[model samples]
Target: MFSSLFKRDDTFYTLLEASAAEARNCAILLKDVMTHMGADTSSQLDAIHQSRRKHKRLTQEVTERLCKTFITPLDREDIEHLSSALHKIPKTVEKIAERLALCPVQYANDIVSRQINLLDLGTVEVVNMVGALRKKAGMEHIQDMQDRLQHIEGDGDKMLMDLLRQLYNGKADPIEVLILKDLYELLERAIDRCRDAGNVVFQVVLKYS
Candidate 1:
């Protein structure tokens, strides 16, 4: 236990921060796609894919570093768990982009935009939480961020229900309904992925608190 003090490595924190930034970048790309519906989104989609690749590479780096290093600032399993959780955010965001690009609908409504906004907010909080790890931030602060994530997730669920209700009301064509529902659920899942990462952060803080 005494050696832990002098053996601390800050590289994990750097990798985690880079991963979180990628997640935020992915969210920003998704928001851009939503705001500029009907415009050429290939560039944005490519950007998301790039962010996803960067994040995946970061996650692998974290794992490889963990294997090589004898001591880590945090628990090995915790670092691995958090890295995996952070990777999911970009992966899900990429899926959302693919779904949107393939969607026949040329425009999005308030619901879609609102969902993307919530996702953006959630990713911002995630970036904050990951940064906090560098300082060994307090449990209360981490919990506060987790609460915000939970609220965003709740809002996402409600918004999805409202959207489905509109789709089920029977005015829209069946094909449109199918596409919209899939896209909506994908967006919600992306938000949920953020919530999952927050939960891992909360648990890590709780353990070391």
Candidate 2:
């Protein structure tokens, strides 16, 4: 009976780990979507959509399990918050992909790709921070991760401004300009989601630590 009780105690940690892994997978999918932005095939977009569906299902399953189980590895609220935040990562990625699919923008430059890469890096850091939650790392390391995410968000903001300026000032066609502008906005929102994820991790650390 004691061993069975111990296993139940570990279930919440396993759920958290799964959520973190899903976030990382979403990040990779978003990177691929950005990389293939100008490609002739829509395979990447399809793949991201599928991944988002899987993430949604996993999050729901974990949430249901959270409600059914009496014992959890951490606060019930923390598990719920973390699960919701992690699930949003892929949803944002899916939204970006959907926008890209509909937008007629043909990017002549690599600005979107560069911004997405930065966001992916920031996301990886956030995932690391979330994983550290299971181990209950020092407050200092969690703060550092939050700081890095903030810096990344700043970079994304700067890049978005520069891209907008170039789009309006350059001799590109009006329709092309509009398309690129919307695409940049979507990419910016994706980065914002990454920062939001980092914030969620920070809250978890602050609450439990």
Pick the TM-score winner.
Answer: 1
lDDT of 1 at 9: 80
Off by over 4 Å in 2: 1-8, 102-105, 170-172
Instruction: Give per-model TM-scores.
Output: 0.93, 0.85
lDDT of 2 by residue, 51-110 (tens): 777777778888887767777777778778878877777777777677766655455356
Clashes in model 2: which pairs? Answer: none
Candidate 1: 10-residue stretch with minimal lDDT = 1-10
TM-score of 2: 0.85
Residue-level lDDT tens digits of model 1 in 108-157 = 77778789899999999899998998888998888889899999999999
RMSD of every prediction = 2.7, 2.8
After superposing candidate 1 on the true structure, give the runs of residues whose Cα lies further than 4 Å from its correct spot: 1-6, 105-107
lDDT values for all models: 0.88, 0.76
